[model samples]
Target: MTSEPAERAGVPRRSLLLGAAAGAGAVALGAGGAIAPPAQAAAPFVKGADISWMPQMEAKGYYWNNSSGVRQDLFTILKGYGITAVSLRTWVNPSSDPGNGHCSIEETAQMAQRAKNAGMQVLIGFHFGDTWNSVGVQNPPAAWAGMSYSQMLQAMYDYVYHSCNVIKYYGVTPAWVKIGNETNSGICKPTGSISKPAQMTGLLNAAYEMSKQVFPSTPVLVHLAQPQNLAGVQNFLDAYRSNGGKWDITGLSSYAQGGNVPTVLANMQTIQSGYGKPVMQVEYGGPVGKPTQVRDSLRAFVTGVRGFGGLGTFFWEPEGYPSFNGYNSSAWDESSRRPTAAMDGFLNV
Candidate 1:
């Protein structure tokens, strides 16, 4: 599914504050105007990649699974390329269709195990929907369709707890847990509107509470799509902080086609210094159609983010593409071969 438009479209704002404080304030700066020193850089700011539907990429007749020996080979390639983390998406229950079987919890756990074995950190992305869930589409699972809003909230809490428990129990402790994917437009849709700051805060708070309950030590990341829009980022954080919501890390999803990398990096620095928290480019990639441009953009973006105090980054999909018969061609070839140009970008960065 395509991503939703920016929620702050046409909304004019007076000031862009990182947190709840109102009025103009001094923007914080990293040491020497750079995010942590090179020696202190944590895990190369995570030149990472996301592989939610990789299993399907193989099933679609693109590549065989021999390269990674059950996908871990992909991580091995990623590790060789300097990628320190991997993100996986989980759905409550996807359709039984063979092509759409990417949301299985068991499968996700196995992938997480592979990543851990490969020495890569894992980020668990919970969609909360049975299918593709994003800010524009936050439909709950079918089982909870008839439940009231309150019931839905409880259900979300339970779902998060159970999922995190499973991951933790399996010895694949996710370094970061995103309650919902790209919540810029807000989850659960019409009912979950960030326009109503109070209501929005309530929904996010429920997720935050659940994460803290499940894994108190693990940092919960509040993800917003598109980093170039500073006003939108500030507005969401303001609303969140106003409603007593808290997050360990400030996360942004930036697509190369959406905005300038420098602008996005600057905005990230502003938010990180303002909030005194580490920032993560949680999701980002170049246009998948242009493989060469995608590679170049990924390299530039990763390097820029690292210089800007970025805690980490994850390429959207290194091994999935629509043109390859709906297969992801970023990481592997039809024979499950190792290291595509896109995969190498992460390592080379």
Candidate 2:
């Protein structure tokens, strides 16, 4: 999600909501742009963020000049904004260096340790690959690439069991574990495709079972992308369930900028009533330049989810500012190097 937007948009650094001076028509935050308390009754599920870039950015000396003119890391800044949770993405094998190193198993554990130290709940997402895994790209991990389908299932189980144990050893138990990242087309190539629901079942069940064995209380999510495509979601889930798939949460990703809200809301309703499953729009955002618009869009999303029986919402990779290297979805003001009102949207009204 981060790479796609940056490469496609070529967005420039946008101005921040001037020091304590809100962006035009932006939500009025507290003094120094601190997040005022949220309306608790309206926010039943977690209000969180996907600042997976936190470790990477902090390592790069990137800092936020908070509204009080004090320098703070993005994690501290987001916590100040009343964010209650954070989602971390981890890869099977660690990548090297600043560019791709942050999401490695070790870094993820360290990052989650810090988030737990901040008192925020955590959610872990496994890409199940050495790199990005999505609809178009679901290459198996190098070590698992040549194995038979059954062997792959065993590998996934062991991986989840070990990963969950490692994450717990860091003193943070994930409240949720998305078994696979954006598995709209399924994971691990021909074996885990929706076209082969039985295989999807094998892989998903292995991860789900191992994850449960380690963290019995945490809900497992079948995260899917393109929330507006209700048909795709329904068809895939139908196939998944028929093939013995199980999940507690319907994790969706969508953006209002694409006219997806109405469809997303309707889809949530159906998935809830029809499938008896709660949903969470796990990933969403718009261009950083449109602070007011993006904030309003996010506010609308959370509000609707509150009514829709969903868990929570997270703005993907809000930590990346000043080029994001290639991720354009950052909510930071490029010029000021601070979070914009879009980030503040997590502070529910």
Task: Indicate which candidate wins on lDDT.
Answer: 2
Estimate the lDDT of model 1.
Answer: 0.65
Worst lDDT run of 10 residues, candidate 2, spans: 11-20
Kindly report which residue stretches of model 2 are placed more than 4 angstroms away from their true locations once superposed.
Answer: 1-43
Q: Tens-digit lDDT track for model 2 on 279-336?
A: 8888888888788788878887888887766778888877677454575676888687
Per-candidate local distance difference test: 0.65, 0.73
Each model's TM-score, in the order given?
A: 0.77, 0.84
> Against the true structure, whose TM-score is highest?
2
| Clash totals in order | 10, 0
- For model 2 the TM-score comes to 0.84
